[model samples]
Target: MALTLVTGGTGHLGRDIVDRLVRAGSRVRVLARTPGVRSNVEWAAGDLAAGAGLQDALHDVDTVIHAATFSPIARRGGIRPIDFFRSPSAVDVEGTERLLACAEKAGVRHFLHVSIVGLDEATLPYARVKLAGERLVRASALSWSIVRAMPFYYLLDRLLAGLSWLPVWPVPTTRFDPVDTSDVADHVVTCAFDGQRGVRTEIGGPEALDLVAFARQYQDARRLHRRILPIDLSETKARGMGFVASQGVRGHLTWTDWLRRNSPEA
Candidate 1:
């Protein structure tokens, strides 16, 4: 059996992928900056930005699932736009290139990457970096699969949490198709083991909802009494995110379903 190496194994999506792969009886290795022991997986201490400990992690690994990212959302506050974009560029773009080089040298057979839907048309710095990373994966010599997923439910939860204190939730004219991270992990793991080559898959949630409606649903689920105020978005911003909202293969869970299961009241 070929050993599968997963990057960002501690992240929301990556951790699920690691668990699914383990359950499926595949040998799994995780690459992280601070590696630790899992029940049935190997870990290597590595940082994509510094290119450290990667070779050791990749050794004897036939499949590489690149799930690591320096999330723009996590680093957005108090940073210049240029710096915001640069941070992910260093990880998503340059780190991908570095990983690809090492994977090729390691003679890895398959590479799977997780990305967001419609990033090619998005103007966000995060989207731009993800698209660049996708391009790098596509250009690689090894057999590769790229799965572009909808925004995760946790992202919506974070947005709602930020606005929970406000009497009125101010939502933009944008829309989203937020899917469960576990569903995305299922697709990613399927692609990893299916022996498919050069495939790009796009996955989304069961329903598309405008920001206000989405927030309203979230508020209801949380048993909160708050008015949803629609804020007009600039055409460029709306168009970019609109493209993201409009694309992908629908997953099993709707936002409401996700909320019912994950919300505090549940």
Candidate 2:
């Protein structure tokens, strides 16, 4: 069997993708910078940033799902003003260039690149960086598909958890369309099997909710009594922070349903 090689297989979306692929009986291999815990699938010791071990990982792989991404600022919690001016990080750009090059040499049949939904919001560094990876895939000689997924639910859940102990939850007047990670995972797996080329149907949540209402629903779901304070996000929105597609292939899971599933108290 021509194995399917997945990059970032241990990451948030990558983990879910790997699970679905394995369940579907596809031979799976994951490229990881370090050792991974999951013993079910084959793990290729590699570093995308260093462009090492890719040749070995891509060997005999017919499908490639490029999900690995890097952003130090986001990892550290929040982005600073100066972060915008600095050049975007390396993994998505240099790593992807190298990955595509190696995949071509290894005769990859299909290259599916996982990307965020808001490339039009390229004013933001993260979106810009994602675009870079997308460009590399499109320009590559291999058959390629890009799945543009909306922000994951975990992002919002983490934001709210930070203020769970506070008396008031200060949320922006801005709006967003976030999808459950598992739902997005379903879309990715479906696309991989469908084997289409070019950018696929953009996916997002069922409804785009206002931040205040979103947080209120969250606080209520969590059985908390914090006052929901709505603050203006005009500046942030102007910078394209609210860049998720207002509409897309809507996910079946609503934010409320997702909260209940993820939070024990909810």
Candidate 3:
């Protein structure tokens, strides 16, 4: 049995990948901020920024799934744009370099990096950092796979939650194909076990919809009636997101289907 180390194992997608790997009978270890024991899974306390506890975590690990990230939205309230870039760069770019060095040293065979779909087209700081991380993975000597997935349904749910209180929801004109994290996880896990290497695959949800339509569907699912106000995005931003809307390996779950199954009862 091959040993796999999953970074950001506590995150939504990372956790799902861990679950899938465990169910598939693979030996799995996770690098977390606070490590502890879990059934069929080992944990190592580590901070990607500080490069601590990685040695123990990477020990005997044949493959690494680099799922750790510092998202900009998580710091929306108190963070500046430069700070936003700095934060993700620290983890996504610099931290990835640190991890790559250690993985190389440990003689890890395969590295599966989870990235965002249309990242190359995106201008956002987070996206840029993620793209940088991808480059690092590609440049590394180890065999690798880069999976670029669309925004997760859970992330959309959080967006809906943040805007649900408004009688009128202001939505950006940019389009999105929000995929389910579980579906993305399945792909990630599949790539982890598969022998294919040095491949870049993109995945997205079944349907492409603008933010207004997404908001309407979200409201209908929650049994809430709200007016949706379309906010015009800059042409550059729209074009970039439009590019994301155009390509990818589509997932099984549509936005409506995902909401129907996952949304709270009315």
Query: Which candidate tops lDDT?
Result: 2
**Model 2, clash count?**
0
Give the alpha carbon lDDT tens digit for every residue of 120-173 in model 1. 667767777788999999988888888888878887788687778889877886
Model 2 segments more than 4 A misplaced: 77-83, 165-167, 233-239, 264-266
Off by over 4 Å in 3: 74-87, 239-243
Residue pairs with backbone atoms closer than 3 Å in model 2 (clashes) = none
Output the lDDT of residue 200, model 1. 63
Q: What lDDT is obtained when candidate 3 is compared to the true structure?
A: 0.82
The better candidate by lDDT, 1 or 2, is 2
Q: On a 0 to 100 scale, what is the lDDT of residue 96 in model 3?
A: 93
TM-score result, candidate 3: 0.91
What do the candidate models score in CA lDDT, each in turn? 0.82, 0.83, 0.82
Candidate 1 least-lDDT 10 residues: 75-84
TM-score of 1: 0.91
**Superposition error at 89 for model 3 (Å):** 2.0
